[model samples]
Target: MADEKGENPVTVMVVDDHPMWRDGVSRDLEAAGFTVSATAEGVESARRRAAAVQPAVVLMDMNLPDGNGADATTAVLEVSPKSKVLVLSASAERDDVLDAVKAGASGYLVKSASVAELLEAVRATFDGQAVFTPGLAGLVLGEYRRMSTAPADDRAPELPRLTDRETEVLRLVAKGLSAKQIATRLSLSHRTVENHVQATLRKLQLANRVELTRYAIEQGLE
Candidate 1:
């Protein structure tokens, strides 16, 4: 996996308590031409190794020795803010999903997902898409909606000015359109669409597409 934000090949770190599962995931990622830079079995180890290696992605398991994945996720981002976490867990409980996302996870997948789905998810996560197991995505988005009950004019922070085209791009983003899909819909080049998205992100002081989408949804863009 090559990090689009940098020149070096992107590296991944696997954080899980089960050795066999961790090793198996590492091997699978490696077989898919991904670089597995480190592995950790607990919250402390995850935070420490993430600080050291600062991998591009962290394949996280919810159950760990020291603490749960949410704790580890917050700790890892504290050390390595650039890394994106994708939860690969056995649990599909609402609290687990929300906790992981709120703690800075970029995606969540149940352990039941096939290897092919996992591979595609990793690729999507690397590309900054907020991947989730089918129903989970809707649940997360609905939570965002529920959290933003107040009308934007009533409680929203003053938003920075966005160009009309940028606003259009953002609405599409809120609708879960990929950059490529947005480009096709808007009759623009993909690079141009990406540029618009990046510009929107910077102007809004957002970390990733997930935040961007939330912002858009809060503003009633979609």
Candidate 2:
């Protein structure tokens, strides 16, 4: 399970009000070579246990008994900044998806996903990719693009000044280019492309590639 530092077999915490769902998710993750750090039924318990364990990923249900999962995501991240929250909810509502993203969730997956899909989403979220249920990624990105026309204050802050290279990388990212593709297009190494992306994320305080793409669109970089 765990390495010498007890960190191997990535740690996961399951937060859902339904006992059956929670237990099943935990079981699946454990079987997939993850350490089930903790399980909780609602926001407060999730927050407390998450702070204590600081799991690498959190599988959260949107409609918790005590509060919405978005709020719980915010609270949990406040305590465990490195933990990625992936919403596993029944709702695929646009507002729900947007809210989770704005609250800093790393991904959103509706309950209709197959076990394999869910597992893949968990891995993607842990790897800092922004996973979304089918059709939902376009919805979120479109909403951000629409918001580009709003008043300046209505949008997120302008990214801290980026170098010309960083800006170019960001534009490519917004255009849906992968790191490898961007590297080849720009005549840069893949590692260099990834470095620029991370720098952009840090400067803009964005969580993942999805948010970075949203920012690029909002800034008219795409």
Candidate 3:
């Protein structure tokens, strides 16, 4: 079932301190047909295992035994830049969520999420979509808006210019519309909408929809 890129069911790593939670998540991923590459109980172990496994997605818990998951996320990305980290934590604190995002997490999900939601989030993360629990999406966008108001840094590189349609698509993306939804709204094919999204990501040099959403907010599109 592997694709051309060798990611068939999508490889995943589960990182959580709690043994039961870790096992449960790993089982769930396996049951959902994902390849559970590894499981770790702490940030340091997670970082090391992530480097070795290079899983497509790392389901990380923010509060780990050795260190914060956010720092581990950064470390993991350093070794496996293509891997996407999705924070699965009980805490919905704004600071925690923002910290993980700044550290390069692809999404954030509270532990209260249903099994279906978790499964969908893992797939979405693999597909480059930004998955956030309920109201947290707006919070993330608001944070970006606040950050954008600050004075520009001279050292910062200029953003690449996007086409009108790309910009429109980005705006809708920042508003949390999926490609299919955007396609329906814009009277375009779903594939075309996905193409536009990919184009926007390339032009913006962004990793995924989360970063794209941040860029849109920074550009005052939100």
> Could you give candidate 3's per-residue lDDT for residues 60-151 as a string of tens digits?
99998788889889988998899989999999988888889889888899999999999989988887777889878677667766766777
Clashes of each: 0, 0, 0
Which numbered prediction scores highest in TM-score against the true structure?
3
**Model 3 lDDT, residue 75, Cα:** 83
Off-target runs (Cα >4 Å) in candidate 3 are: 1-7, 151-165, 191-195, 207-210, 217-221
lDDT of 3 at 29: 84
Q: What is the C-alpha lDDT profile of model 1 across 110-144, one tens digit per residue? A: 99999999988888787877777877766765666
TM-score of each: 0.79, 0.78, 0.84
**Prediction RMSDs, each to the true structure:** 3.4, 3.8, 2.9
Give every collision pair in model 3: none
The candidates, ranked best first by lDDT, are: 1, 3, 2
Error of 3 at 207 (Å): 5.8
**Clashing residue pairs, backbone N/CA/C < 3 A, model 1:** none
Q: Name the TM-score of candidate 2.
A: 0.78
